[model samples]
Target: MEKMKLKLLYADLQSDIRVIEKELETALDSSSHYLKDASLHLLKAGGKRIRPVFVLLGAKFGQYNIDDMKNVAVPLELIHMASLVHDDVIDDAELRRGRPTVKSQWNNRVAMYAGDFIFARALEYMTNIQNEKAHQILSKTMVEIVQGEIIQIEDKMHLNQSIRDYFRRIKRKTALLISSSCQLGAVAAGADDSVAHHLKKFGYYVGMSFQIIDDVLDLTATDKQLGKPAGSDLLQGNITLPVLLAKNDSAIRPYIEKALSGDMKEDERQVFLKKMRSSNAINEAYHISNLYLQKALKEIEELPANSVKKSLKDIALYMGKRKF
Candidate 1:
């Protein structure tokens, strides 16, 4: 019943995602050959499109104008894409969703220029809306998001960090952009302040849950499913929730410490990953994410009941249950 229920929620947004894909290509159309090609490479690679869909769905609760709503949706996706390009460079990530990342396909200089270019383009595109609140919300989110990345870098390899620190970092790194997505969508469509606030909270909670699940899958899911090695986060020295939780287990402590403290040979890395999978840590982390999903659903339920609201609720559930 739970699995069937989540499928139905995702079904609601499938068509909307198709519409957004077309709009995104149009948005990436640019005169500069290098920028256009680079941006298109990333755009065409595709994503869950969760942020733009949230923006569009939140808009429907108010005025329901696709044209006016698209102004916000496109830039929201562009902002997200811009961040991804930069993130790949910072993480030195070679792949995303099974394809070579921008930095991997091109070079770091191109990735940086491409990210900056798309960010400028996002601002240019969004200016059509003429709403000061939307700008303020998105702009502030962008700044905080960068700060969060900086904090993550600073905290990396420092395995002694607390759970509160992990939550705070993920909130800034992952949740803020998602929260802004919902907020900008509502404000662009002229929804009242209350609806925007609820959607913002909903996005924040779901974003946290979504990222926590992603971290879990980075260990539990197969390499093919993750498009990277399992336990890549730990290998990269970014302490995630499951790692934090498992480190508390006396039996699990050595594996966690060994993974964090040194250059792991292939066999050692596999042993550490196996230990994490066997521990209760992954289950405990999923429980925490489920709590956030429920909180997100509670916010969605507060909105007027409609197919869109139902779909958003379903997406929240889907994030909790996604396999990889």
Candidate 2:
């Protein structure tokens, strides 16, 4: 399981991660039963906890201090959770991690309110660290992520969009936050500027690889693996690297065009997915993701040759080969 893999990768930080898990649960205590339940639902569903892992790892660059580092780790995860709640509403997603999404259980409005409340909690947690630089970095990242969401909405159904556009969007959407986690974590623990920069760059490369592989999995993985349809991204008009590459084939172009036009029927969607799974697009996407993995390794190579570097390097290798 991915959870087991993460634990193995972070074997040394097990106690710190457990502390973070407990903190996540306690952070949601609220007077409103509805808000409390909605937030708790998402928390209990379980996730890879990748952001928090990065935050903790970044802290290792400086003197490892769970107390100060947690202030950064908790909110990085809270921001990610808040984004997922809002994303479910925007995507009309019914399930997340094999359970009902907040929007599905309650409604869109409730999901929005829940997301806002969690974000507020993140800000409150952030304020606890009096570092103005950390606050500014996080604030800018929040704005960029929102802009990425808006661009995704606007670019959806536009199959001809440049590959550059797709890369930029994913960078803002996924990579920025992860990069911030590394940077902010280092800053929180008083890492030197050079160390923080390397960690931030490392996070960006790994984050890009992670999301690209996720997009690839969306096309190739089973419904059970994804906890949703395999072609959910295409069904939702979110063109990823696989879709873009597959669209160039004369044999599959029509099906892909139909998907882009928002008219893919059930059978067509299945056929499209099948053809895509067999196509070279998956291979091409993997090659690109491998590039990112290599870049990530290169960035972390500048850090001290220690267990922290070893774990980060292992995680990059794992991202390239991950199934879910």
Candidate 3:
């Protein structure tokens, strides 16, 4: 099913996501016309807004107020979008979400300035709440997230790294932001400490599973589905879970190793994709993701049995089962 149709299952949070979308547009606007246009270029390129959805759902467990929560919710998404613009520059990425990436559409210098501008705008928006705890959590998450990307660059082409290394990288790169989203939402709504804690844990588990599935789809899904080439990670020399698992195979390891050892032509890239898909690697990776999904569902079960919680549970389940 389409991501939107799937999200409609969580009807309770629909109004909140809509609020966040509008808030995001307002948040990205700037006094400087250049900054406003640049930020809006990335802003108008929509995403699933899953982070804000988690933020809103977590708020439901407390004295939920959309006005109170939008301050946190809008900034969180802008921070994420800012990172994406910078990441495309770092990766030399040409496209994002099936459209020309900011770095590709403009020069790297413009992209960098745009990202910095948006990040500052996000912090400016966030400052309205005056919550030191929220700032600490989000600031630290942003730092660690950047550190994770640096380490990912370090780990590239080193095929023999342990599974623990991959786990460590993804936890910082992907899971922490989602975790913070839930915590910030709870904090904004003045949810009890225990409820905030549980929601944070739930976001972490779901984020991990969600990212693992994304990595898997990088090797398995079509360019149309993924908005990029299949095996793009492999071609980029970023060893993901499926590649790491496939490397453990005596028969399959050498092909992937050989593929990684040098520059990949289009024909070679296609062969690498085929082998990775046919290997037990993808299956094993799915198994690992399912474990995290189960843990995520367990966290959801601990929340009050409200319809919002139930819908969050369904989204977690859907992450494990998504094919594209």
Candidate 4:
């Protein structure tokens, strides 16, 4: 399976990842059982943990110490976790990774408080690093992420947005955090500035490709694979790469309009889904994702060839080609 392949690619870091996992568990501990449980809910559901993997791998280019690297890794993952909790509330999402979201399990107010708590924990852990550059980079990334989400909210259901708009939104929504994971990890480990720059570029490209594929999967993958309904992005009025591309066709545009207008019937939704699957839009999105993948590989090529480089390369390839 695709997940198995991704796990195999990073198998060498299993022990370090375990340490990060434990640290995450410890970080979620709180006096309020409600906040603790809400915070722990999504963490328990699990994720690819790609952010921490990038952080750890980036550290490999410098002084690879698990203790030092974990400081960066754990907080990056926590930031991502906190974002997801907030995102679910924003999206009014019922499920994440096939399980009930915190907002759904508890309430929106609880989810918001839990998100704040986790973000506080992330900031607490980030203070362990003395690297001012790392802090600056992460702080900027966090701000951009919030701005991205704000833009997404504003752009919601607006079919007139350009591809440039989509790209700008995704860069902040997803890419920056992953990019920082790579850059900060290297900086934390005392890697050269040049090395960190290259790693950061690599993560940026991979993150872009990863998100494009995720958008494609939201349209093409089965509900079981996606852990939610197919076309959820479209249903929620978030125009993704495929929808933007597909909407250029007059036939598809009207359906998307109806969906966005909040009057689409279930059958019309299926019709749109069917047309999108067979359309060139999906292929076009994949082409863009592949381009980003190639750029990521180029960034990897700039790094010194080593097992870690190979691992990063493998992960990039997986991101471009992942089925779910």
Candidate 5:
């Protein structure tokens, strides 16, 4: 339902979305049967295509051309898709969107190769733009994304890290790519730098709020809503905002500590999740997500006031209020 709200909010771009969607279908023309299958499996598993939507929205600030914007929008989404395949391997995740992840459907090696192929295809599409800044920003973002994942592995099961640590991680791991999506779209369409800058900041704030809400929903939403077990992040030892806030309670720290120590059994997972959900930690995390949304709204206000701006504002609000 929350996702549907976004689709309705941005319905004006349905035409642009159709073009990007078709581009995604043909983005990877791979020879390897397994590679094609794995890529198709992930692609067929529907997503909101929020990154491409932002790309289209950003392009609205300038000479809107679906043809040119598809270059940026498609490649941005491909880069994101490639990251997800690799992420399932890192987290040993089995499901995404209620379907088996590429790593689970095939194998780690195949998933890796598929990810590489998708990334290379993204670069191939990106090179057509001939914008050095876009290329530089995306390449740097790609490097930072891997670095963020590396740090996630380094900090896994170590619950003592600060909130700033988590912020830095998400900025690289998630926000940067979305930020680039907006900037690349605007720049590609010949929007002025000032407008591009505002949209980039807008994407960053929206991305931050979105990820925080994602972390909160992991603890609060049901398996049916999440399409995976609730509290999967904690189970996988990913220390998210809810876990961090819950740790402030002396009583809850030991459970998290035990979970991090590998003493948490499969059956114990539900008990810990229940406690965290019943606590004030959820509220605290929500407050933070709302804070990010407020910042995102300010960024949107700076953008040219129009239907596109309204849609971007709607997206930020959805992040705060989404059930999953």
Candidate 6:
């Protein structure tokens, strides 16, 4: 299966990932039982832990010290976890990775508090890193993520938004953190500036491809696969790459408008989902995603040949081809 293949690519990092996992458990510890429970709930739901993987891999390109790398890896994953908790609140999402979200399990206020608590823990861990450049990169990434989310809110349901608008939103919303993971890991391990720059670019391209493939899967995959209703993004009025490309067809425009109008029937939504799956829009979106993947590979090609570089390349390929 695709999941197993991706896991195989990073199999060498199993021990390092375990260390990061334990650190995450320790990091989420809190005196407030409520905050502790809420944060723990999200953490237990599990994820690809891709940010931490990128961090470990990036570190391999430099001095390759697990102790030095964990500082960067732990905080980045924490930031991502905190963002997911808050995003569920914003999306009013009930399920994530097939489990009830923090907000759904508790409530929105509890979720927000939990998110803030986790973010604080992230900063606490980040302080372990003395590198000023690492701090600067992470701080700016955090700000960009917030700005991206705000822009996503502002652009919601507005079909007139340009393709550039979509790209810019995703760059900050998703890509920057992954990019920072690579750069910060390299910086933490004292990699050369040129090497760090290439890894950062590699992560950026891979992240972009990952998000686009996600958007395509939103319409093409089943609810069970997504852990939420199919077409959930459309239902929530968030226009993604596939939808933006699909809207070019006059036949699809009215359906998109109806969906965006927030009055679509369940049956009609199903029809729209089907139409999108069969449309050229999906292919176009995949094409764009492949282009990004190629760029990611190109970035990897610039790095000195090593097992780390090979793993990074395999990750990029998996991102382009993953079904879930």
TM-scores of all predicted structures: 0.93, 0.97, 0.95, 0.98, 0.96, 0.98
Worst 10 residues of 4 by lDDT: 35-44
For model 5, what is the C-alpha lDDT against the true structure? 0.86
Clashing pairs in model 4, backbone N/Cα/C closer than 3 A: none
Ten-residue stretch with the least lDDT total in model 5: 261-270
Please state the error at residue 5 of candidate 3 in Å.
Answer: 2.4
- Model 3 lDDT tens row, 156-269: 989889899999999988999999998888887788888789889988998899899999999999889888888878767788999888887776676676667666577777
Better of 1 and 3 by lDDT: 1
RMSD (Cα, Å) of model 2: 1.1
The C-alpha local distance difference test score for the whole of candidate 3 amounts to: 0.84
- lDDT per residue for candidate 6 within 96-211, as digits (tens), equals 88998889988999999999988999999999999888899999999999999999999999989999999999999888998999888888989889989999999999999999
lDDT by residue for model 4 (24-74), tens: 999999999898787677667888899999999999999999998888999
Q: Is candidate 4 or candidate 5 better by lDDT?
A: 4
Instruction: Give the per-residue lDDT of model 1 (tens digit) for 1-324.
Output: 434555466675567666777878877777878778887888777676778878988887788777677778888889889999998998899998789988888799989998998888788878989899988998899899989999999999888999999999999989998898988888898888999999999999999999999899999988887788888888888999999998878777776677677667778778777888888998999999999998998999788666788778767888877886
Tell me the TM-score of model 1: 0.93
Q: Which candidate is the best by lDDT?
A: 4
Each model's lDDT:
0.85, 0.89, 0.84, 0.92, 0.86, 0.90
Off by over 4 Å in 6: 1-3
lDDT of 4 at 260: 87
